[model samples]
Target: MWRCPLGLLLLLLLTGHVALGAQKGRGRRELAPGLHLRGIRDAGGRYCQEQDLCCRGRADDCALPYLGTICYCDLFCNRTVSDCCPDFWDFCLGVPPPFPPIQGCMHGGRIYPVLGTYWDNCNRWWQAGNHSAFWGMTLDEGIRYRLGTIRPSSSVMNMHEIYTVLNPGEVLPTAFEASEKWPNLIHEPLDQGNCAGSWAFSTAAVASDRVSIHSLGHMTPILSPQNLLSCNTHHQQGCRGGRLDGAWWFLRRRGVVSDHCYPFSGRERDKAGPAPPCMMHSRATGRGKRQATARCPNGHVNNNNIYQVTPAYRLGSNDTEIMKELMENGPVQALMEVHEDFFLYKGGIYSHTPVNLGRPERYRRHGTHSVKITGWGEETRPDGRKLKYWTAANSWGPAWGERGHFRIVRGVNECDIESFVLGVWGRVGMEDMGHH
Candidate 1:
């Protein structure tokens, strides 16, 4: 009796769910055109029996009790559904006068004429919860939360022209990893949590690595990002986000103490409840806890141990030039644009891919992010095409991408990674502290 559009009616007939749609007139509550009501239960009663719902081998949220699962087909159970659900093809695939269910025709609540990709356990679980909508976040929210935080004046975009020397046939090594050369110098990846403090973290981390490498393992200090996040508020906002150049400027003037002295909570003043006054005289000094006071960099005349970064410069646009900078210095800070698909990246070199969200304009939503460029390598494809990638260290923790690091398409500046690269020199005079 319900008049569905011609397309829906045809789809229902083709899928053999026409009988299900026809049950709407018989006192059956019609959720959607083809969706029918099997039964209903009391408010507190179980929605769907344990054995009734789809398990799909792994005990994920599919088994959870949902109001829809109790009465509707398991194919339409949770708020989101697709062919990935268990027994989807067995019972719900072309229901009456069953026809051979098309394999790979549907996935994660989406229908594809051809099988470009299929759903798996990881994608199913990730898609169910971790998206812009599920987290109550929109592209605007992400842009405001991440990219909008940094002040416009702090952008070092035009610094690229400083190092435009062409590396003509420099004959470089096959692959290079900064950590391999500077063992124990590059610190492990740190997590920034929900805050947008990647700017501060990447700056602080780059400074730490450069200092250790520059001093030839003499001044191997894990500089404190908390110092930059909590104390450096001149032209930047903590947590809410700030520019990396401002952080580097803060480092150049008001050196950061060791993490042992002032640990990093990763949150800035906004999210970290309240900001504590910069500690002047702390027991933990640069030279262990024994020293009463260590020399603050640039003669800050402050009590806390201070470190300074030399004036930051830009890196070349080409991979060869960037590699040369990495070999000479240490890790450099890079700001890149992040797309929606980037969140689901598990491993391998990442490239921007279109997400089929029933909308063509969804790709416009992007957020700016920062990372440390540590190394580079090349991988040959089966078709003889070469995929060169830049090794980037992210602040999202090691469990994220390739152990807290990800490789992006190199040379082409995928996601504008090669667009803005900045490097700084560590302050000298920390070689042999007490051994000399």
Candidate 2:
């Protein structure tokens, strides 16, 4: 081989090394004049940085929440326009989020989103107008309105007491419905309007069912819940709400009339003022706004028509025992805890979904509500899972879920429905004693 000058050979080697260094430098352009490039992102094909606007002039780089300097090429992000890029690129280039499809159900002129963030869902419902908008309430607010009225707190001791009285392992019939046992006795579900009076409605409704059942269908009276809502102010707070125990006491002492006499005006307000002050019979002098003092405040002419219930008592929390109580005494009232997801319940045996928006552990329940447990049954879901559920009558209205009724998961104390069950006997008067 021809030997060249050593100095020249060394110079050649140095040149090669310098060229290689230049090539490496070119691969990573300085984000700023002196800053180094962050890196290459192959996911959506882009460059990102924490301190430099590397996404400028690029289509793919504008796909993320504007984190000041970082360029995200992700499909989407939650819209926080203040934190995002300018118009059009403000919400991940209008790309849909990688989330579950938002499901919704409409009732009583309100459309409720069944999934997604609770706040978003409620916001959507609030905008839909109707019951939710009528009260200017969000989903939580609506649920709170209904739940706030339940005054009975969950008591383990009470549940244990019921357990002792009832056999836990007792096998209940596979299926049973109170309406079937006593036809025409179970009245159609009543609408409580926007008022948080389900406690009273359920109490009156259950008592009415009991009256019919106990009297062997000889008497099927549609007791007035309006009476419980307006009057019965001792332990119960009219439209503000009341406890099942308080309602039972009122029924036992003061009895209500037919809904025909004293209808529900809880929703009927004068330009959104409190419902016409408990249209009561004026015992004072001249004829007052009420129908007549001739009848009880409940509006029943004959005192015999006025029915009362015995003191309310607790029942076993187990499903079997609950069924037995229904079979024997008609329907029982159930005070249940409501979660954020319950408002979207449309049909099927309702069980709280796994999606709990990181709610604090201390906030046990969003609210409480009471409903009448009319029956129980087992259902097979489309996925082939067996679902044991209780049929509950709601006061929302016939327009809501399954004609003003809902089926809830049973035996598991779902939504704490079985936590505090109440039962009572309708005291039979001479009139009732002979009718049935």
Stretches > 4 Å off in candidate 2: 1-136, 153-171, 268-293, 296-304, 359-365, 381-385, 433-436
Q: In candidate 1, which residue ranges exceed 4 Å CA deviation?
A: 1-155, 164-169, 266-277, 280-304, 356-363, 430-436
Screening candidate 2 with a backbone cut-off below 3 angstroms (N, C-alpha, C), the clashing residue pairs are none
How far residue 232's Cα lies from its native spot in candidate 2, in Å, is 0.7
- Clash totals for all candidate models: 1, 0
Query: Could you give candidate 2's per-residue lDDT for residues 239-355 as a string of tens digits?
Result: 667877777877766666667667777553213555445543323222211123445444444442456667777887777777778887889888887664455455556666433
Q: What C-alpha lDDT do the candidate models reach, one value each?
A: 0.57, 0.56
Give all TM-scores, in the order shown: 0.64, 0.63
Q: Pick out the ten consecutive residues of candidate 2 with the lowest summed lDDT.
A: 35-44
